[model samples]
Target: MSFKGEHHPGVQTPTAESAGFRFNHTMLRVKDPETSLAFYTRVFGMVVLRRLDFEEMQFSLYFLARLGEGDAVPDETGERTVWTFSQTGLLELTHNWSTEDQPDFAYHDGNAEPQGFGHICFSVPDLEAAEAWFDENGVEFVKRSDQGKMKDVAFVKDVDGYWIEVVQADRMA
Candidate 1:
């Protein structure tokens, strides 16, 4: 299948060197790790696959993923680290020390002027149920499924104001 619009000249078929390449994770800098972690884990039901701390650098990295049924995390640290890196659709939250203590500290959410990075998305089984769950959890909504012209897509904001797009893929079809 081809796209409707004119294609880029630089676009080419995948090469053997890129055969095994996969999107690993997208990193977002957060002001507070605890708040961001709680929102991601408790609200989104994502599991913390691995965490790394650079004491000398005064920063920490938290890797999270939504695992499927019967998926098991490795008991060994090295194995778990390897396993964490191998998974797709992971979210990495980076926290620099002492940022949380500063009341004025903020991260650019890329929704304002000169917008660039937009949002991360999650596909749900039921859009209505997910919207209800987000409402119950007191999540800040950017747009609801029934609110906009786009009927089946919703957007919610995290603790640090990063947008998360929610959609029911089956309904979209």
Candidate 2:
């Protein structure tokens, strides 16, 4: 199917003033939840805000975020679901049940030949410090902050081989 949209140089799409919008979350399929969860929590200090299991569907969704200090997650599922929707900067990891038994299972990281998806990014307060911590923690590095042509950015791979771009907030223009 062919899709087409034309953009006039100075034209802007209109939306109702009452409409509210926000970029909610991006989901990535992971082979192993334990390893993937551990990597995000341990390396980035993200908390598992909510987890929804679909036994019949044979898949699970885990939502994680780096909440503000002293922020608490709601105990009740309904309240938690509301809280989850209200917050921003969420990372959702979807795990398929069958992948657990297949030790050799792997997912297309989107960076290969048929590249459709790129990489997810995280902004750090101190790029050097984060890079140091990553090195100390033995995390795999795809492109170190100093090695590539883009000297200000760094890329690292999670357990599932998904590339995450790490950038410094202050250094960004």
lDDT of each: 0.92, 0.91
- lDDT (tens digit, per residue) of candidate 1 on 1-173: 66545568886777789888889999999999999999999888998888999999999999999999988889899999998888888999999999999999999999987898999999998889999999999999999998979888999999999999999998888
- Candidate 1 backbone clash number: 0
Index of the highest-TM-score prediction: 1
Number of backbone collisions per candidate? 0, 0
Residue 50's lDDT in candidate 1: 87
TM-score of each: 0.93, 0.89
